[model samples]
Structures are given as structure tokens and as C-alpha cells.
Target: MELQQMRYVLAVAETANFTRAAERCHVVQSALSHQIKRLEHELGAELFARTSRRVRLTPAGEAFLPAARQCLEAADRAAAEAAATVGEVRGRLSVGVIPTVAAVDVPAALRDLRRRHPQVRVALRTGASDDLTAEVANGRLDVAFLGLPSSSRPTGVQSHELARDHLVAVLARDHPLADGGQLDLADLSAEPFVDFPYGSAGRAQTDHAFAHAKLTRDVAFEVTDAALMAQVIRHGLAIGFLPSAYLQRAPELRGLAAITVTNAPSRVEYVVWGSPGPSPATVAFLATIGLQPTPE
Candidate 1:
């Protein structure tokens, strides 16, 4: 009859052990048994055949199981919808981002999100683009800011473009190509290169750039953080590609050089939602942050 009763029934059906079910449901075994007895009394039939060794569902219980599940699912959906309607977008929002985006302008976006949706708490995690994409697809994350080279058809999830960022090669100020207005892959091929971890969005871009130009790199180091890579380049260790947005934040790396790559692809950042679409707060947060909704 009640949602809690339905939930209890589902849990009992899963475990088939009163003590285990009660523990999983965070209730006392006696209370669980009493509630099941009450439910059986209301239905005028025993839902479970209890024995010393174990409990098993009865015919009636088998027939009622699907209906009980449906009832609980419907109630949960209705509650979620009602919460959205009331604009009560107040809950934990687990967000994922690639290291480049996390260090880029993504923080500015979060500041705006918090300013608009003060009640929505956020947890930020950063990883490689592939890892973030997989997490979003598998429902480990509620939403994420994923670099676009990693973007593809949203299989089992919904996604929208956040922004387009220009990709540039970061280099040491005194390096030969630094002062040259523009440099191609051929010019930098022999230059010691710092690259993103293989399989990352930035590395994908780097690979593509080299592939397009028929060039190869002598990578000296690989790192996830573009800012740190910039530092590495400053010391003339290796040079790598990063977004222009990264330049705006690193005032300390003043002597570092950034050269816009010609004929190379730019990176697009996306805001992705893990299954069941966005919560009201998330929707509003995206809108507030100016991410255009992707057509369904």
C-alpha cells in the first residue's frame, strides 16, 4: 500500500532472508517481519512461505512482485517530477571534467552555476577525457565537461555543447619557433614534445595534428595538466598543445609561448548528462552557464 511497504517487499524478494533484507533496508528484523505480516494481512494471503532455513515467495507473491516493483518505480519517478516542478533542485550533483577543462574556464562556469543555483552542491572530479566520457556513459557521473575530440554520438546518454576552444602549441619563449608568428607540425617535429597521456582528448588532437602533417614527435614527457606542461616548456623540457583559455589563467607563466596551429582541429567542450537526463537544477545550471541544449 505504502511506498515503504513496496520497497520492503522488493528488498525481501531480493534477499529472501529477513535479517539480511532488514539490514539492507536499515530496519530491525522484527519491524520488517511485522510489516510483511501486515502486508500479507491486507492482501489476505501469505506473500512468503517462511521456514527455519529460508523464506520463499508464494504464488501470490510472485504475481504481486512485478506490480510492487512498478508501484515503487512510478512513485520514485513521480517524486522526481514533483521535485522538478517545485524548482527544488537541491541535491548532490557529481560532476566530472577532463584535466584541461578543469584547469581552463570550467571554474568560471561553476562559479556562475553556484551563483544561480545556490542550493545545488557540486563535487568535482578530474581525469583523462576517455575516463570522464566512460564515467558519464556508465552513470558514475551525473554530468561532465568533456573535451569534444572525445565527443561522439551520445550512446545511452544526453549531451550538449558547452563551448569551442582554440587549440595552440605551448612552447618555451626562447625556442626557435616561439617568436615565429606561426609554426606547423614540421617545424616542431624534432622539438622535444610534452604531450597529454595517450588516449586523452589533447593527445587525440596532438596525434591528429601530426597525422595530418605527416610528422612524428619525440615526446620527452607526458602529463595531464596543461599548466604544468607550460611550466615544463618554460624550462625548455618539452612543448605541447593546450587551449587558449589556459593562457588566460597562468599569468605566472608569462614568458611561455602559445602558437595557434593552422589547419589543425580545434577542441569543443561538451556538457554531458548521465542517463535519465538532467535534473531541474542541472538543467537550470546548464542554461545559466549558457550551454545550448542539444536537440533530442
Candidate 2:
């Protein structure tokens, strides 16, 4: 019933081991076990099944875990709101970002957020579009900024369109076609390709573009890091496709040429948020970063 006891229960449920959970919670193992016992005594039900080899959540534990997390999140939000009322934004907001945004925008955006709301904290996690979307849907993240399909959208989360980024071909400086102002998909059909993983949304856009031109690329490598792919392109190992933003801040891939594919598709970057809505501190941080909500 106590908040600290609830935290202990949630930590044990998450780690599935008293010893590991204690380490995570910065407490001793015996103390963590004692708190869990107290919590189980109060509820009059066993929350976990334990053995020397492993610990697994019982049915009651499984049902209680999410509710515990929600309670903690709500409590944290309430505390943040109290702080905000005193002209301070204090709390952590976890954000999932795609590579392009991390490369081009996050540094400046984070700087602005920090200066404007010194007490507010931001944690960033980066991954491919599908992975980021899944995190947002699962309540693992407060918000996500990534390039997504224009036709599809986040199902349970709210979304806002931020900007459109063009996909262009990245080629080695020494390549003959690098000097070309614009290159068609047909022009790179036979070139060795460094591309996104096949199932990724970015890959889908790349594939769709090639299909439209009736051309297939020779993919020599499939990579997820935009900057690394740019490096591979720079070394003449393969040609790659990426948002133009990749080269703007990438130090390893300087002087790489991007030829706008006349027939290529553009990707839209959106900001998606989970339920429970943004805290006042999070709202203040977002406005500071120039991503204010649209007027009704």
C-alpha cells in the first residue's frame, strides 16, 4: 500500500529476480524480499513463483504490473504539475527518435528545451520507424519523432505532422554520376546498393520508388544507421538512399553527393504521443522546441 512498497513490487515484477531488482532499486536483496512479502501479505495473494533458477510472475502479478506502472506514472505527473505551478518544469520525458531527426534537429532542440526548462529532463531512444512506433503504442515512450508513411498513421496515439524530408541517392564523390544534379532511379539500377533493412518503413519507401520506375537495385548491404550508410557510400562500397538530412551533420560522410531521384518518394516525419497526455512540463518542453500544438 505504501508508495515505496509499490515501487519494490513493480521492480521485482519487472526484473523477475529479487537480487536483480534490488540492484536496480539501489537496495539490498533481503530488504527487497521483505517489502515484497509485506505487499503479498496485504493483498493476500502470491505475486510471483520463485525457484533457484528463475522467478516468474504469477497470474496476480501479471495483472498488477501494468496497474502499478500506471499508478507510478500518474504520481510522477502530479508531482511534475505541482512543480510547474511554481514556474518550474520538472520530470523526465522519454522520447523515441529516428536517425534523421537525431542527426539534424535534436541537438538544437534539446539545447532550447534545457535552457527554457532547466528542471525538466529528456531521455532519447533511437530506432527504426516500426520499433519507435511500437514503443509509443506500448507506453514505453512519451513521444516519438520519425519518418512514417503518409498513408498510414499511429492507431492509439495522437500524431502531428512536422515536416517532409526528401529521399535522395548518396553516392561516392569519385563516382561519375555524383556530379549529376538529379539522377533517376533507372540511372542507379545496376549500382551496388547499401539500403535499409527490407521490412523497415524507410525500406518500403525505397522499394516503392524502385517499383514505380520499373527498376530494381543491386543491394550489397542492408544497414539501419544513416550516417554509417553514408560512410559506405563515401567509400564507394555501395550507393545508398537516405533523407537529405543525413549528410548535414554527419562528420564521417562529408562531401558525399546526393542526387535527387526525380521519381523517388518523400517521407513525412511526425510526432506521436501515447495516452495520459503530456505533462505540463512536457508541454512546456515541446513548445520550447518549436513543436507547439496546432490551434483548433
Which candidate number maximizes lDDT? 2
Residue-level lDDT of model 1, residues 1-296, one tens digit each, is: 67788788889899999899999999999998888889889999999999999989999999999988867755654665577776765555678877666233667777887876677777889877667778877756767777756334345667766667667888888888888988667777888888887766668777776877888888889887766787788898888777777566667557788887775556777777766665555576667666545546
How good is model 2 by TM-score?
0.82
Q: Per-prediction RMSD in angstroms? A: 7.8, 3.2
Local error of candidate 2 at 181, Å? 5.3
lDDT of 2 by residue, 1-296 (tens): 87788898888877878998999999999998998899899999988999998999999989888888888878888999888888888887888888776333765776887887777778888898788888878877877887865555666666777777677888898998998788788888989998888988877778877877787778889988887787788788999877776556667667888788888767777777765566775576567556665423
* Top candidate (TM-score): 2
Instruction: Count residue pairs with overlapping backbones in model 1.
Output: 0
Question: In candidate 2, how many clashes are counted?
Answer: 0
- TM per prediction: 0.67, 0.82
Candidate 1 Cα deviation (angstroms), residue 257: 1.2
Q: What is the C-alpha lDDT of each candidate?
A: 0.74, 0.79
